[model samples]
Target: MSRRNPSRNGKRSTLKDEGMQGDPHAISSSFSSIAVSPRTPKAAHRMGLDDETEDVELRLLGEDERQQAANGLDVEEQSGHSTHSLSNEDKRAMVLLCVLYLIQGVPLGLALGSIPFILREHLSYSQLATFALSGYPYSLKLLWSPIVDSVFFVSIGRRKSWIIPMQIIVGTIMLYLSLNVQVLMDDPSNHVTQLTFLFTSLVFFSATQDIAVDGWALTLLSPESLSYASTCQTIGLNTGFFASFTVFLAFNSEAFATKWGVPHLTLSAYLKFWFVMSYAVSFWLLFFKKEKKEPLSDVDMSIKAVYKTIWTICKLRHVQLLVIMHLFAKVGFAANEAATSLKMVEKGFLREDLAIAVLIDFPFQITGGWLAANWSRGDYPLRPWLFAFWPRIGFAIIATLIVYWFPKPPITMGFFVFLIIHTVVSSFTSTVQFVGISAFHTRISDPLIGGTYMTLLNTFTNLGGTWPKYFVLKGVDMFTVASCKLQDGGSELVVKATECVSDHGKAACAEIGGDCITETDGYYMVSGLCMAFGVAFLVLYIMPTARKLQGLPISAWRVKMSDS
Candidate 1:
């Protein structure tokens, strides 16, 4: 039989010469002449070649081929140590990913960070709980993520098909909101429901965009650059969040604007600005960015198959444990993360001052994320996540103390400095934990179902934080015991605030020269309980499970599809 020589593409080689099979030297020489390139040891092993077979294969290679193989091995060895190095293409992909993530963060920042603080004064804790619902779309995105992954316009590109449309919808919603958000906030008591529904829709579109971008991210950069995906996400989201929350809050605060002698910004103007920015970015992506089509694979890409894959992945014991970990991991920090800042605002802390603290904390957050990416790049990616757990809970405790001891408005410079230090330290640790977990997720995520897999994991992480927040907010109001002090004629009477649940009742209490007094602040109690849960959960569940999960082989995290 005649075979084409791989080394000399057009040359015909005879493999059936008499005695060729019996003569080992002749066979090796013949194989060497036909060989193209050497397989990596890993590839050889995966092909079921034993060490003896690999040695034989190596010995069969021609001298020049052997030298080429040696050089390839050297390059790979050097690359192992230089993962930080990125090609120009990688850098561009990183920039593109960061921009996309940053765009997602803008609306999220305004809804979750800025609006909550703005409405805290006008709305009660219960009403704020409704606004908190807007955050759920993100946490619940996993439900629809499979559809995003499985269904798309192949011509428009899998990721771009969703990203383009979602961003356009986001821009439209922002434009609509820019026209009405201020009016809604002006009478928050009467319009809280409408405001909640509006922002919820905005957040929903943003979450859908996140799923597509996440999938695209897996393919956008080279495998070596994959570790930076989480870092880009952290930096980008935080920057957008910084702009919408810290910058916007600082400018929107009349007190801050006057104090700094800067032009004041209104919510309407801010929303309008983001609307324009969103549209601009969306258009840039639609026209300039071209998504590379994914190659066909054995695994089905249909919607049913994608969802079945999700189910199969969920059925894995390790995944179930990880999901459980994601669901309850944030319980300890819930009250502190969700309520502490708003409580401080209620305690007379200026919104602008709070903004300043976040502004200072921002750099550390980015730095921490970068550091975490390095720490998580190793085999034990969850190490940093576990290490930061206790420190985060401790920070929560410290935050509680700070909130309790917070002095009245016009905070002293010393106190402000203390708050900033606390904010920076706490935020740094939190960022580390977030990035560490995210890096691990990126490490384990199956690229074939990148969108659904990443979204499923991220959904649980977000839910862990999101689900607890609403309860914590409600718990604060539920646990709080307050009274109104009223002077009737020459006698002073105290009426329970709980009895004044309605607007008319509250108005009546205020009309009778009543002053609200908190006999028992729920913030302290709720924070204490959250901390306790966090500590117990860490000691009992997280540490042990995390170690096991991190120790698992990459194959364990991947889908085990049949060859058939």
Candidate 2:
């Protein structure tokens, strides 16, 4: 007769039914008997059981053991703490997510950074403003984020269903645009409608893909490993930016044409390459990558529930404050960013020079992200945001000074050195601030509605960073000493030169060429505006908010999902 043993769940099991328990050498075949109570209140309630009374069985010994072994988690209860360690699957997840993030950065770098320089000569300040506005979809992605969160093709994996299709659409658009690049470059004014249509569609599809990627990241990373999310984003996005901004520009640059035996590559060729890369990566992910098949309970896929969740997060007091801060934080930098490239080109800086400067500054951006992630982990987690904002404010002032005083025409070696230093320091400050802010957003965001919540906050942040560019571009004409409306019939020809006289006390405006005649009144105005806002932000928002929020628990922020 076999003896019976009682389980913690109050079920009696015979030794004969499971395995012989008395043999010292017999490893308990009742390993399957080991059960896990729900670690979360939501999970407990969803299953209609209390944490103490739940009978969750571990079905597969090998997989569970591998996870625990990889992460070094003890079977012994530790009361709600999970120390992060990278399993093989977690490593694969990071690589895939990082690559996807890099892909997202490509269009952004071109639309926001590179193309402005490419079209600088052909477009007016107002037209440039229109170009900048083409990126507005990024800031408004939250509106359709719910669809991304809820709708899915279960056959092709939940997130991939969104990501793969969007990538294909993006590639097709880029292919068409690439083929039309030369025609548009030849007659930009006439092609404005076509250019706007294609670019705008690109932005829309890219933003939708971003929503899916953000939601996918939530499913891919456990809470313990979440801090690394910002690092992945920083590195990956910057890498893509490097490709779009530096590599693309380098090939198109005069220096590369002069030195290399190879001819300068056309913008169309670059775009074709971009299309191929996007499609290749998408196809590889589609065939090779495997998303962990989670139960539907992992995410509340109900559309109503997602909207309700988004509303709840929005209503939280702390969340409101954070959103406002993010919205306002970059107001100082917005106009500065939009006008600087044009201004630099006007001052005789070549495309190659700016490309090289960005290349040199890239390493510092990666370092800043790494440091921010490590520093944000211990005591006073929010301290990095508070500390970083001040240096950035100072850098903004320095940048403003650079714009104001640099002499018109003939950029000297000394001036180039100054520009390089400014670029490096600015990149460092911006990266630190970005990493801190991103981590803060990730920490506060509920994984339950990751797509909507993250995009909502990012939209506000981008609004602060980008919208001011529209006004800055508009205002550039305000302090103009002279204006020339260049007509595109077959060649660049000045149709009319209005206000040919100097306004900002420059000598011989009609003689002195380029954007110097524009007088930088817009840049000066934005600089002063940023300084004022930075001071107010520091005294009114950051100081008090950081002091209050730094040491407190996450739940204290009032954004914690009740079920999660």
Candidate 3:
């Protein structure tokens, strides 16, 4: 005989039958039961369990636990299989998704990271500000993301329709740039606009490809493996960025090439190599890989309906708060992020050495992302993000100090070690903040409009970082007060280096035996201002708002759309 707990519908479940009375693993078994037996509306109604009852039960579970249970149920219902592990098909899809993301990262890496370093020597900061427009397409992709989501050739596949063509366009741009990149860089001051236009177009296509891949990822993996999509994206994009920036800089540098007994790789050669890779991957997707037909829930939405939904999402209060936050969140780090490395280079810290520091820091970035993912799976997902914010800003200030104290050319090994350590620490905090915020975004995004929703959030995040860069670069020159000193028979004359704004002016200055002396470096002022702004933002707004937002019920974040 066993005691039974009776339900409102007069249904009873005995402890003995459930193995809870005497089993040592009752807690674990209870969780298994909950995961395996999700409550449907019809079943709940039949059991006389109201919505209130369901809410009460849900409130008892932690957010992560609830998510896990929901994910498990989603998997079981969709695939009619155990939710313990991924199928081979799911694993294959993961690999394919990673490869696609890697392809997208190639041109983006060049535009964002490598090109600035390459152009810094020839172009003034003001000119570099114009070139930074190439990175804007990525941030502004949200404007057309809905169109990308809604319009597609059904026979060719929804995502594949955009991805394949976009990749091809990206490859073609790479090929075209391969022939002219050196020419553009050789006289960057005159051709900054041309280079900006080309890279902007390339990034435009790459951003569209990103929209497709993001949507495709939702359907590509089984629900059990859905969570891994972010991991794949982080890993793949970082790898491609590393290759284009660190590896390219290292091999392309004359000093590094000579030191390592390797031939210097030209930018054209690098671009050509990536172009081949891009074409191969794009063709493989076109001919060999097949897109799984999306479900009716995804396919039935019209372009108009999708756009309407996006508009509705934009209007939500929670979403509006998040968008505003994303738009301004990077203000604190803008100067440090955009100007520090370039300033270091201007101080004679070789680009090759900077690349090496980034190379050493890369592994820590990956590890930090992984660790942050784990830490974010708790009740307060944004805890890691908020916690890392101070340290990241602190490191930004430290970066300015490092740049200020940079040793003369041929930097000492000890100084290099110190630089590497600073880079790793700064990057680790950044990765943690990135991963934590991404996890929160994942938690809140509407699955019905998965691609558009995710893209909307991501666009703002990218914009937050991108929009400040141009201003920061421009501000460096604006705030700087420098003069060239020329000596004539021991009497020194100082002339403003306003004319030294271009490479030709610099050459002219040097030819006249004039030394450019900076009376006030704008880097220091901008760094200080950014740090102060970051601190103010953290204390006055971000901290309070984040705490309040994170405390909101999941339902508070959802939009209610009529099924008319």
- Indicate the residue-level lDDT of 110 in model 3: 87
Report the CA-based lDDT of candidate 3 relative to the real structure.
Answer: 0.71
Clashing residue pairs in all predictions, respectively, total 0, 0, 0
Q: On TM-score, who's better, 1 or 2?
A: 1
lDDT (Cα, tens digit) per residue for candidate 2, span 336-365: 677866776755678877887888877766
Top TM-score prediction, candidate number: 3
Ranking according to TM-score, highest score first: 3, 1, 2
Return whichever of 1 and 3 wins on TM-score: 3
What is the C-alpha local distance difference test score of candidate 1?
A: 0.70
Predicted candidate 3 versus true structure: per-residue lDDT over 281-370, tens digit per residue: 888988898887643321334556556667766766667878888788889999988988888888888889889999898877777767
Q: Each candidate's TM vs. the true structure?
A: 0.83, 0.76, 0.85
Against the reference, the lDDT scores of all candidates come to 0.70, 0.59, 0.71
lDDT of 1 by residue, 311-399 (tens): 87686667899999999998999999889999888778989989998898777766665666567655577898899998889999998
